[model samples]
Target: MTQSMATRATVTVAAELTDRCDRCGAAGKVKIGLAGGGELTFCGHHANRFADGIGTAAERVVVESGFGWKGAQPI
Candidate 1:
């Protein structure tokens, strides 16, 4: 089932994305906190493209405010 916005709020949402994308050195928009304890940050483009896979494995997701992320839902 899809998660509601309220439930999604549990994940950290930053005002601005300051990190560079791990895949490509672009402005990061999404941050995926791994279940095992690390994190991966991504730009909007890469994040959406890999959303499905990342969503399933992430522990917590932190997206830039106002940035629409395909993998915003909690697994």
Candidate 2:
């Protein structure tokens, strides 16, 4: 059977909670708003490890785009 829109929405909301990877800080496709009001963006690793911890500690952890930490660009 097909899922209803309401069900999908609920699933979406739940999925949002599992976005980023806490360990490596990998940002996922969707960006979610945190409880405290801040933002957090992780890649994949970091989010998984500390997702719960970070979420509780801060409001949000926004994921950053572009170059590396050292600000180095590829040739």
Candidate 3:
């Protein structure tokens, strides 16, 4: 497979397998990768709450809203 295709496949798998928030254990809606190292997972609520602090330091940030997932149901 081509490099971009492989990267897409990897991202799909990661999305399927990623666990819940590191803080409250709710389903993660945002993923933050650090420039130095490590990563953080947070639900939308916590992600927004902490964005001012950690967002500035992140090297990469991926956010998928709750409405974008197959498993998410209406409130």
Candidate 4:
């Protein structure tokens, strides 16, 4: 795969605690992987507020909405 696709493939749910919001510095509940090899974390409110921008720039978006649901697994 290309470098960009490789970066996108690397996006994974943080196994530890949640990250800090990039906007308000609150506890982050959402994580977005950018088109390149960068990521942005945000709380629920900020994620909602910046949904459009995130949707536009993000190659992958993962939100931890308190369900504690981990990501997919190998079959």
- What TM-score would each prediction reach against the true structure? 0.79, 0.32, 0.60, 0.63
Number of the candidate with higher lDDT, 3 or 4: 4
Give lDDT tens digits, candidate 1, residues 1-75. Answer: 564333322367899988999999999999888878888999999988887767677878898999988666535
Using TM-score as the measure, the top candidate is 1
RMSD of each: 4.3, 13.3, 10.6, 8.2
Assess each prediction's global lDDT (C-alpha) against the native.
0.79, 0.37, 0.55, 0.61
30-53, model 3: which lDDT tens digit per residue?
676777788888776776667555
Order the candidates by lDDT, highest first: 1, 4, 3, 2
Residue-level error in angstroms, candidate 1, position 4:
14
Query: With candidate 3 superimposed using the best TM-score fit, by how many Å does residue 36's alpha carbon deviate from the native?
Result: 1.4
Judged by whole-model lDDT over C-alpha atoms, candidate 3 comes out at 0.55
lDDT of predicted model 2: 0.37
Q: For candidate 4, lDDT tens digit of each residue in 8-46?
A: 223345544368998899888778888887989877678
**lDDT tens digits, residue span 8-71, model 2:** 1101212343456433545463233456465555554454344344434544333334312111
> What C-alpha lDDT, on a 0 to 100 scale, does residue 21 get in candidate 3?
93
Q: List the residue pairs that clash in candidate 3.
A: none
The true-structure Cα RMSD of candidate 4 reads: 8.2
The candidate 1 region of ten consecutive residues with least summed lDDT is 1-10
Q: Mark the 10 consecutive residues where model 3 has the least summed lDDT.
A: 3-12
